[model samples]
Target: MLKLDHIVKDFGNHHGLRDVSVEFPANQTTVIVGPSGSGKTTLLRTIDFLEIPDSGRYQFDDLDYDLSKPLTKQEVLAARRKLGIVFQSYNLFPHLNVLANITEGPVQVLGKNKQEAEAEAHDLLKKVGLDDKADVYPDQLSGGQQQRIAIARMVAMAPEYMLFDEPTSALDPELEVEVLKVILELAKMKNSIVIVTHNMDFARGVADKIVFVEDGQIAYQGDPTTFFNEPNDRIKAFLAAGQFNVK
Candidate 1:
């Protein structure tokens, strides 16, 4: 469903991604694993059009985005509608209550009426197990609750592809599982998902494909089973350095 060809992004003298190429199938979960500065987040952001590449091409279904050309505002918005990106931070609006925050996108982007958006927001809240917190403000909820609400807000937009950048990194151990449950459930759905995560167990359990990125390039890409069980020396070294226990 998604393809990146020779994608390269440079931030001054540092390279964010170099000659990165990969294809993600429809309705499958792909987990990108790497240490810090490994370009995992950059890859996700590029796909979401949050970071435009200096060169190369990105394709989603029939749509083609040439990074060499300047991106039009309308094109960027159109591309974003099909994808939802959850940042490391919850990025929820502090001023808006849970319901209002969740419904804003639909009301503004989708042009749904306020009443209709609110109704949809309620259903999304229930889906993420946050129906009771709909009336609560973001500050009133726990970190996990806020993250789940963030997920619900994204789901409300009905994105065809979801990008998760270290979804559980900001949470405590106990809180992490709560957010992971929602993400795991989303993985089971028939939609494309790209998750950049350090949670080895979650990646092993939910990913159809595991991509190990290092130094701004794909070091290894394969089935999760093989990746966990029979990784190469480079991968083993990386896993060890990251203190990722594969069990």
Candidate 2:
């Protein structure tokens, strides 16, 4: 499980996060949905230590960390290892083939033997349904395929929690289905899979719980069923704007 207590981040004049506190339960997936720039990405980044919060307490498994100050190199590395993230862009290395890209981190950062990393990379490729593209470069694959490989690359590290920031936002509608399927498959692994998405349909299908964020704070969060049925005006208005059908 991962918990953020009173998380806050500031950008000189504006606040990126405002006392954001949320918990991602173990073996479950939580979906975060909100308007653009509503602190969704910032929250994910902080959890990954990509953007350290100004102040907060983070609890992961048996560890608890105070985030009010800069973390040491070891601390940052340790935090990053547990929380794996995928960005809107696939962010694949054009110079490497699919298999090579997937194995790079394990062999380099995790210090796994090259042969062992390759074996695991192949398994991950199969998990993402891209086993056939092992030798292909990022430039040779479609956007969806590259994203799947990206997911595989992250998975190779065996993170305890996974974070996705608008994974489908950059894909065309048709391409999104494949990527979403891979994510849903990951959800079945019973890990903490937190996704920030604007695709309401996809969100409804995969989320065990829904978090509605607004203006740098979480406005509402609960089970998916009640979240859709809620009569709160602000939430209702937001859903209406997105044309999301309330379940």
For all predicted structures, in order, the TM-scores are 0.95, 0.95
Question: Which candidate leads in lDDT?
Answer: 1
List lDDT for all candidates, in order.
Answer: 0.89, 0.88
For every candidate in turn, the CA RMSD to the true structure comes to 1.5, 1.4
Alpha carbon lDDT of residue 193, candidate 2?
Answer: 93
Candidate 1's displacement at residue 31, Å, is: 0.6
Native-referenced Cα lDDT, model 2: 0.88
lDDT of 1 by residue, 41-159 (tens): 99889988888999998888778988889889988887887999888889999999999999999999889999999999998788888899887899999999999999998888888
TM-score of 1: 0.95
